[model samples]
Target: MNARQGAATSVHVASPPEFHAVTGRSFAAGTPTKSSQKSDDRLTTARLWQVRADPA
Candidate 1:
C-alpha cells in the first residue's frame, strides 16, 4: 500500500509500540525505522536533544 493508504490502514495505527520494532524503541525513543532513522536522527543528534525538545 501507499503512504496515505498505509497510514489509514488498521495495521499501522493498531500496531502496538511494544510489538513492532519500528514503533517500539524507535517511536518510543523518538527514532524511526532504520530506513527512516536518518530523518528523525536529525531531530536530536545530541544525547540532550530530548531534554531540550520534549518539555513533558
Candidate 2:
C-alpha cells in the first residue's frame, strides 16, 4: 500500500515477515498515521474473507 502525506510517501505490504518488518520500520521511521489503523482493519477483514472463502 502506498500513502502520500503532502510531499512524503510510504509503502506497506500485508504479507508476513515483510509485514512485520514494514510495520516496525514505519513506526521507528516516524509518527504513526491514521492509515495504519485502517490497514490493520483491512488486513483483518481480508483474513476473515479468506477464512470464509475456504472449503471445509
Candidate 3:
C-alpha cells in the first residue's frame, strides 16, 4: 500500500500535559501496522524520555 489505502486511523490529543514521573506518559499513534505499533509500544516499554501526556 503505497498510499495509506486501508486501516486509516486518527488520534486526538486534547491537552498534551507535561510528563511527570508520577503521572508521566507518552503519545504515539499511527496505522495498525507492526512497525507503527512497535514504535508506539517502545515508548511505553519502560518509559525512556517522554515529555508530554495525551488527553485521551
Candidate 4:
C-alpha cells in the first residue's frame, strides 16, 4: 500500500452480520425464482420495476 494512492475514490461497503444491504430497490419478474437446481442464472425481461409505497 502506498500513501499517494487514491483512497477517496474507493467505495465503502457497510453491512452487518446475518444480513446484506444492497444499493438497489427493484424486483425481477422473469425467472421462476430459486428452487434447487444449483444453477446460477439471473435474467430479467422487464424495462422497469416499480416499488409501491404506502399512501398513509
Candidate 5:
C-alpha cells in the first residue's frame, strides 16, 4: 500500500537481516506529511514495501 492510501488497519512482515537499513521507520500509521497524496518517494529509494493481509 502507498502512504496516500491512509493508515493500514494491520500489517505482517517477514524479518530480514537488513530490514532496518531499508525502512527508516516502522510501517505504522500517522507519519508527518503536508499531504497524504504525496507519493512516498522515500520508499522507492529505501526499497521497502508495506505488507497487508488478504480479505477474509
Candidate 6:
C-alpha cells in the first residue's frame, strides 16, 4: 500500500517509552521477519504520531 493508504488504516495508539525503545532495539538487532519489515515499512511511510526525544 502507499503512504496515503497506510495512513488511512493506521490507528492512534498511545505507546509507552519502553515500547518504542524495545521496538527500536528489536529493529537494531536485525532479526525482523517479513511481517515485521512490512510493519516497519507502514510505520515509516504513514503519517503517525511519534515520540520525539527532548532536545534538552
Instruction: Name the best candidate (by TM-score).
Output: 2
lDDT (Cα, 0-100) at 30 in candidate 6? 29
Query: Relative to the unseen true structure, what is the C-alpha lDDT of residue 34 in candidate 3, on a scale of 0 to 100?
Result: 37
- Which residue ranges in model 6 land beyond 4 Å of their true spot? 11-56
TM-score of each: 0.20, 0.27, 0.16, 0.13, 0.18, 0.17
Error of 2 at 18 (Å): 45
- Clashes in predicted model 4: 0
TM-score of 4: 0.13
How would you encode candidate 6's per-residue C-alpha lDDT over 10-41 as one tens digit per residue? 22222334344333323222233234665578
User: Which residue ranges in model 1 land beyond 4 Å of their true spot?
Assistant: 1-10, 13-33, 37-56
- Candidate 1 lDDT over 1-56, as tens digits, reads 67765455445435667555434333213334354555457655564676778867
lDDT of 1: 0.50
Candidate 2 vs candidate 5: the TM-score winner is 2
Query: Model 2: how far is 31 from its true place, Å?
Result: 34
Compared with the true structure, all predictions reach lDDT values of: 0.50, 0.51, 0.37, 0.29, 0.40, 0.40
Identify the leading candidate in terms of lDDT: 2
RMSD of each: 7.8, 8.5, 12.3, 15.9, 15.4, 12.2
Better TM-score candidate (2, 3): 2
| Candidates, ranked, TM-score | 2, 1, 5, 6, 3, 4
Deviation in Å, model 4, residue 45 alpha carbon: 24
Better of 1 and 4 by lDDT: 1
Candidate 3 lDDT over 1-56, as tens digits, reads 53443323222233333222212233445312234455467656535344334333
Candidate 5 clashing pairs?
A: none
After the best TM-score superposition of candidate 2, give how far the Cα of residue 33 lies from its true spot, in angstroms. Answer: 23
